[model samples]
Target chain A: MTDSITISIDGVEIPAETHHTILEAADKAGIYIPRLCAYPGLKPNGSCRVCTVLVNGRPQTACTTPVMKGMVIQNETPELKRLRSNLIEMLFVEGNHYCMFCEKSGNCELQGMAYRLGIKTPHFPYLEPKREIDATHPDVLIDHNRCIFCGRCIQASKTFDGKNVFQYIGRTRNKKVGVNADDGLGETDFAATDRAAQVCPVGAILKKRVGFKIPIGKRIYDRSPIGSEIEVQPKDAGSAQ
Target chain B: MANVATNGKRIVISPVTRVEGHGKVTILLDDDNKVTQARLHIVEFRGFERFVQGRPFWEIPVLVQRLCGICPVSHHLAAAKAMDRIVGGEKLTPTAEKIRRLMHYGQTLQSHALHFFHLVSPDLLFGFDADPEIRNVIGVARKFPELAVQGVMMRKYGQELIKATAGKKIHGTGAIPGGVNKNLSIEERDGFLKDLPQIVQWARSALKLAKEYTSEHLKELADFGTFESNHLCLVGPSGELDLYHGNLRAIDAGGKTIFDQVDYQNYIDYIAEEVKSWSYMKFPFIKSLGPENGWYRVGPLARINACTFIDTPEAEAARQEFKALTGGKPNAMTMAYHWARMIELLHAAEKIQTLLHDPDLQGTDLVVKGERRYETVGLVEAPRGTLFHHYEVNEHDQVTRCNLIVSTTNNNTPMNRAVEKVARDYLSGTTITEGLLNRVEVAIRAYDPCLSCATHAMGQMPLAVELRDRRGELLDRRAKGVDAR
Candidate 1:
């Protein structure tokens, strides 16, 4: 038997399961908590602090923190909105995300979050760090310029695909996602059909020869905002439909 | 910079203004203060061709648009056309081709309007000798309020058309490798239809103004920078004027056909680029004629001279009157670019109106693909002149090689020729006057060159004049929009 609990989010009390994280609970009740590093069915790493919210008067990542009975969470406050926006802006400046020409532009989660948060232009000065590109893979390519280090592929490959193909290589500012083999993604047993290939939230790790397959208006994010799938239709309502 | 040591004097114009990108002019004179050599130098360098390597071929149409803010649509379409060939989708569906054509006509209309009213009007209305402070768009507004407003509205209408067809005014994703991304909505079509008549009327008025200005100053304008040169442009299958898709055509000053109906994909066989150490922009000329006599003029003047006739009624009438000025020969008068540009403006307006009424725009079939190829070339007539985009893609769909011959680059030699002619005709003595400096600018302005597209750079600087003696010592320095000593 699963334990049931109730939580207060932005002054609205919603019933949730004990195992549900703050993001999962809020999503169940059709309340959108903006996030980037978190995805459906993937374990949350909380690497990106975009989903940071005040849980019981303390800032915590909503995607990693579990829901408790009668706990008060602040998600849509002005202060929290500003913090989330700042985090999103930092992610943008730290990477060379040329959204205009990127293949994943209309479908990219980072770009979608920017659109949802109304970030016409980032306030911070761009770092414009030089990055490397590994296109040796016959079926896949990685462009480090657009990588946000979300760790979704890292988790998805290991847990879902049952393969340990990706890992974090460097430390601190020099850190980047490294392949399991020495040569590049080509040396690894990473196929384009792997679950990891479908989990990238950005254009960093892409399957070759499949870019811009969808037109402008029919893209994933073009139909709706990033979190509208959760906000517009609740879990119960979506199941009933 | 120039070799002032060998010359008697050198006049350095650090930057040219009222143009799209950054450029400088250095006029070297003999001991008697006679102009001997003049070169237009492209100061800024953006290695766009090198940067484009290793990028995905499909992303090129949108990526190359970053080349120029003023004429991005030209790059977008040209790159898309090349990619279409790479994907073996060169035979675009009627709907896709028409939509792209609509976008192109909008670009020409808006770019021409902006250049004529905002950039060149002050020179034409106030005369070349007018005060520098009062000779600009602001002066035009203060003197001719109604005309200024018309210019603004005309430009705005063209922008709306671009937004409707291309998806946005900047960085549009409407055009793709195989075809365009969207069809014109009925609502968008009706919205443009509402303003079509007013836009056509403004285009006619602008044409009349340019024609009257040319006629009033015919004798003086003839001697300004007049010279015999070859003309180049793209002509339709039947020798009609077509800006979007056509075959290559070149005509000599005496109306002799140099090349007609040559396929642009084999442009290398007919045309070649020559590099000079003094300028970053390459000089493009006809291969058979050699670099000396092969240098030709492009843009509006070239189009008017190369095409047999325009399909539209009003622009054809205007073209007929324009041709009569040169007795049906190629018009070599440099200032006549303004008049030819207005005739194109009218033609672009007429194209937009006709395309709006075509039901093919609302058709659903947008893209098509076939067996793939690796290397391809695409060409289109931009607002300035013919633009070329060539790419070689690998099996992985990554671009292996890239090359671009922008319109302004094709006109590099001719621009230098015009600068030298103006320098010899108007410039005399050691002292530099504002009116005399403006005469040189007026000659370059006739071409409406976009140095940014030619040099692949972004920043533009002001025009400065520096007169130095044979010893290379700076004597007098005067700059437009800059402090003068």
Candidate 2:
């Protein structure tokens, strides 16, 4: 077992493991550092800068940066909050996020983050990129319009399902999640029950015939804001990771 | 060309005011100052059909409500009903159906209250010929503070009812494909019940105000853009006024049935829309009568004329008095729309009161599904008129085609007729007075036209008036509430 180390975050010292990142350590201490591209048990991609925090007076992604002894980090500063909100808004403008009708509206992490961060509207102009929806799959759908290129599905498919179904293709602004198989998702060896199908943080990868199964008030984030669960964890609660 | 008024000049009121959306009126005058031609032009175009293509079928209900802010609940429910068919969920559970009804009634109550008090009351209370600045909602507030408060409170109550049932005041996702997403909780029901009686009492007072105003100004209002046309709406199983769900019913000026008990799913078989080059909106007519004379009136007056009796007591009694005014014939007076609207407002209040008492609203059986279908049509009696939503979903659950015939579109031809009638009766000299502008607006307001949904736009645009000679030379131009050259 790795030895535990103490790190000061926002003026409070918290115990962290030798290999734990700032986000993992903060999360274990009941502090939620907002993230989009990083998930538990998955390698931190640091593609989305929502969790950017000050570490030793330098900005670093809390998800990707490992904790060190006597390290001082600032997570909830006003500058960091604005920075995170801007990153969230950038994600909104990069895709066609129609939250009003989106099946994943109340349950979506991206939307829940926006609600939690008090983003009434995105400051950036909508790109409104015309993207094709691959509905050729009989039991799965990929609406590229709502894709944020977070690569969670890509990682989940490769790591959890032992299948290389999704990948990041293209470069810069045109970058998107691409399928391994030719033609469409229907032609791919993908199942609706796959971990990749359920790992999308947005409405991009949705199972067919099962959208909006949960009611409004009963949805995951309706009663509580995003990150509330992590924030309400016991101070010494064990981390899922 | 020969019978021209003042060298064939045209008086154009671009972007009519105090209405939901943007609209314009062009009145052509001959050399003798006779109004030669009048047209109410819908200048904005909402390509909602093209926008909806390729979107998943399930998204249609919540997606279509983006069309209008004033009556989003109407569109939401109408589209959801159509999607329900696509999902084989048309036979909704009791809880689902009741919740939807509650939402619709709440919408009607709020919409009617907003229109009557905020939009229409200014003209009625202060007189149509009053100064343009003082003849508005603020003026009504300053002069008749109590009436304004009543309107605000009534609107707020109805909105709260919608929020509780629909989940939000704006772009609600309460109604879904096949069923509602939520049931009215006991707590929400109690909260609304506490305020129900007050809303009903206010509705009664509003109805009385409209009734007295129409009676006092009967002579003047009789000739105020009044025309004999067909009236159409939905009627319940026993021919009661049903705003939420009912078979289609149409009545002639004499209250004679043109058609009754026709399933709205086959609405295309009976009703067809005509596209005129002058307007973006379509003129829907009874196919049997043809576009020439098949044009009919809808909304409050039409609803009152089409239904045999209202279900609720106070509204039923009010409807009787309204019908008796025309000796049991369809009331053709345009201004009588106010009185008719108030009656419906009271009916919606009474319906809300009754629905709150039902235990089904709290039931957990909120959804049902059966055999799936491809193409479907959903119709609802929106606050303005009958709104039609038609869609065709493919096997992949994506919408292949969509067609929406909004209430304002249904009343397109009738609105033009009203404008022409008002212009022909009021326009005198080339000098465009504020009274003339107000008169044209008053006539159009009778229909409560929502130009936004007709030619959809977001932010409010001021009403503009352009006076031009027959030679297309600009004479004088003025935009109300906005400084524009």
Candidate 3:
């Protein structure tokens, strides 16, 4: 007999592994709770709360929270949906999400989530924060204006490439992505093939000498909306339909 | 950024139509109801200069190219040329130079096709007063299906050339600091050559159509936004028409060469940029003449006017007839820009065939690697006009300081002057008509300014055409989007 526990997500009773988190169980059950900073290989940072759900009558980051037996987890409630969408909107206003000007427009996970949430415009005013570009690397460019602080590059670099080419420096308000080198990206061995370079969900870190290689309308997310594949629909999911 | 001397009534055309990026047209009227100053304001602030500070020198070409989607290749090449100087290889390998030249011609063909057929063709074809609804590409297809299809096909071939040379059509990242990333594949080269006949025919037909249309409307075509002013452009070593790259030249309104063969890196020695408080766009003027007298024009008309000859056969033939339009002297008429654009398109096509026949373009050695250097200046003639990308990097090869003199910024003063002239001719009183607004936009559009590439700041009011009174009260505001017409 398989060791499993019955967990009630929204109204459906589903079987899950003993130690699986709500997000992992939900994924196994073909559900997408809209996540960032929680890639499959990396340790969950739970910084971007796009996957916040109601667990035992309280809000928790689904990536970190374990699935409890008979916990009555609410994955797709109206209140949870609003909370997740508001978080996405906040992320947009906080950074420079110039979708029309951005190279990562259609393929962007953040943009995809916005489309999935039916967000044509953010509720909050654009921050338009001044950011710098690090073009010191020979084969890549880091546009800080579009960084969303997902820590994917940090995790991916350390986990996948066995390097710490990127790291989050400073605290709230004065924080930014810092390169490993003291002078700049030029002093680092950051190749275009690095996993850290490829992990950017936005246009923040882009491979040099390959922009617009894909025409405008023929990109990854251009043909269809984001998150349609491998996304098992929750019968009670809110507003996605 | 010119100051308006007028006092009372004001007409503001915010978010001007049929141009790349956000811009504003403001006409200040005096107490006598005559025009005082009309200024074109470039609102968006990309701040590529500030943001590119910490990046490595090699990344300049790719990053700076993002400044404009329509003319990324120009930025890409300019940055590469600057980097070339830093490497002490300002002159690249023969093969590399030929490939770069070919890529530039591709850019010219695509950009001119887009500008002529997509942006301003309707006004030239159906009159400036054509319905706003049909003043776009869709309308072009509806009115002249063959011309519209040709335009699309021209753009397609141009895009195919870009894709074959670099990687993609819109913002291909082919040109690097030293040279290109790769040589043209056999398939890509053969495919482009196969369509040579069709491309040449279209260029010829475009010249004919533009000539007929321009001659028929000679009255308005000559008088519309036409002015005698100093012109500036890049010319070949022997004064043949050079678009991709060349030393800068200046000519006075009377068609006499004022300055010739001045290298671009030394532009600051002869050229000076003046900052205005009212606008983010800086006015670039000749250092000797000062701001008021030094303001000059650049672009297709200015290039055709300033150049002594066109190297290509078909374009040269077209150029002769165009030069005859003004008794062999440089024609200052702004409407003639379309004709000059077509002529250049023919030249570019001819140049394309020459480049394709050259075996040098197929050489295996592309980028020439060398020790990194501190600073370099790159200059290229964008389809709109001249563009400069200057950068100073640290010992670690990180860019520390930067300066960019884009073509639109170079035209800011003349563009404002053109607006003022049009406002004086069109605006009668405080009441502004749709025709007046359209004409003002038409005058500004003659420069074909790309505000997105020129300026980068984002959050601004959506373009509005507002009529304000003496007391600073908004009198009338138009609708937004397609209904703005």
Best of the candidates, lDDT: 1
Using DockQ, give the best candidate's number. 2
- Candidate 2 residue lDDT tens string, B1-485: 01112334433333467888766666666666566676777767768888888888878888889998889999999999998898899989999999999999999999999999999999999999888678899999999999999999999988887888788887888888889888988999999999888999999999999999999999999989888999889899888999988999998888999999999999999999998787777889999999998989889999998899998999999999998888999999889999999999999999998999999999999878889899999999999999999999888889999889888888887887887788778766665666677887898898888888976554555445555456556444444544222
Q: Candidate 3 on B1-485: residue-level lDDT in tens?
A: 11122234333333567778767655666557666676677766779899778765666777778787888889888988998776666667788788889888988998898888888888888788777777777888998999898888988888888877766676665676667766776777899999988999998898888889889989876777777888899999988899987899999888888899998888888888999876788999998999989988888988999998999988888899998988988888877888899999999999999999988888977666576577778888889988878889775457789999888998898788877777778776576666777777777777888887876445443344444444445443332343232
TM-score of candidate 2 to 2 decimals: 0.95
- Residue pairs with colliding backbones in model 2 are B4-B30, B4-B31, B5-B29, B5-B30, B5-B31, B6-B30, B6-B31, B21-B452
Model 2: residues with Cα > 4 Å off, grouped in runs? A209-217, A235-241, B1-15, B459-461, B465-478, B483-485
CA RMSD of each candidate after superposition: 3.4, 3.3, 7.4
Q: B145 in model 1: Cα distance from truth in Å?
A: 1.8
What is the alpha-carbon lDDT of model 3 when measured against the actual structure? Answer: 0.78
Residue-level error in angstroms, candidate 1, position B151: 1.4
Worst 10 residues of 2 chain A by lDDT: A232-241
lDDT per residue (tens digit) for residues B160-200 in model 1: 77777776776677788788888999999999999899999
Work out the TM-score per prediction.
Answer: 0.93, 0.95, 0.72
Q: Residue by residue across A214-236, what tens digits does model 3's lDDT show?
A: 54446767676665643646443
Task: Show model 3 residue runs off by greater than 4 Å.
Answer: A1-241, B1-15, B133-135, B370-372, B457-485
